[model samples]
Target: MAKDLTVKDVLYALEYMRDALVRTPISDGRARWNMRLTGASVKESVANQVRASGSVSGIEDTGTQIIVWRVAA
Candidate 1:
């Protein structure tokens, strides 16, 4: 059976993934916009959690549970 992820694990995974994304800027702006616009719910959820935790960057959630965090300027 697949290992189940706890809430903490999911959060950490999302954060880590967002950090990794920061290192490489996405090439396709349209695709990025589409993804972001389409996944509003996921982004909002991540953003809410990050905000509650006092994180630096703003989170852009995609509704599919995939989070994209903006690196702090």
Candidate 2:
């Protein structure tokens, strides 16, 4: 079954992504990953947190999904 993620779940997932990007690298540095959204509305709030967390460089919202990246980091 599929489940919608809550704000808290998103935050934790972001933390995990941050840790992965910071610690593990695709090759030289963290590039990006396509993160699943709990809902469309979650994008508005989480986008800022992702940027502010500095876990990723930024995100690309395509209405359908958000891609978390750390290319600059």
Candidate 3:
């Protein structure tokens, strides 16, 4: 069964999938504006989480997706 993911879990998953994920900019079409807005909101939410957690090293924006990496202590 699939499990619910916490913010930390999501961060870890992003790190693990970094290499496999790609970000592509949405096309400049009115129909796609909503999707673009939704993506931006999700990115902002992730960014907020990263800022709250010192465990996260940084985030990379691929224009299509965000990747989170852990900080090495």
Candidate 4:
């Protein structure tokens, strides 16, 4: 079953994930933000978030119907 997640929920998840990486010394990082929405909505929301916060560099649509958000260094 797919999970219904709102824009706020997605953003919160991303923030939490980024906070969790604060201790690690990594050059580049990536995090996957999965949403139950359709492909178009997923793409739109991802783009909005990327524009709102420059932290997100890009997004990838996994063949398994999952959206992956690539965090900028």
What is the C-alpha lDDT profile of model 3 across 1-73, one tens digit per residue?
5443346545555455442112345666212111122232234454456546765443345544433355331
lDDT of 2 by residue, 20-52 (tens): 211112465533333443322343444445556
| Candidate 1 collision pairs | 39-62, 39-63, 42-61, 42-63, 43-61, 43-62
lDDT of 4: 0.38
* Candidates' C-alpha lDDT: 0.35, 0.42, 0.40, 0.38
Which parts of model 3 are misplaced by more than 4 Å? 1-6, 19-43, 59-67, 71-73
Candidate 4's residue-wise lDDT over 1-73, tens digit each?
6555556556554555441111111246533333333221333454355436644434333322222234523
Q: Give the alpha carbon lDDT tens digit for every residue of 1-73 in model 1.
A: 5443333543454455443111113555312211233222223344444435534344344422323443422
Ranking by TM-score: 2, 3, 4, 1
- Residue 53, candidate 2: how far off, in angstroms? 1.3
Which prediction has the highest lDDT against the true structure? 2
TM-score of 2: 0.33
Instruction: Report how far off residue 32 is in candidate 2 (Å).
Output: 19
Cα lDDT over the full model 2 = 0.42
lDDT over C-alpha atoms for residue 49 of model 4: 55
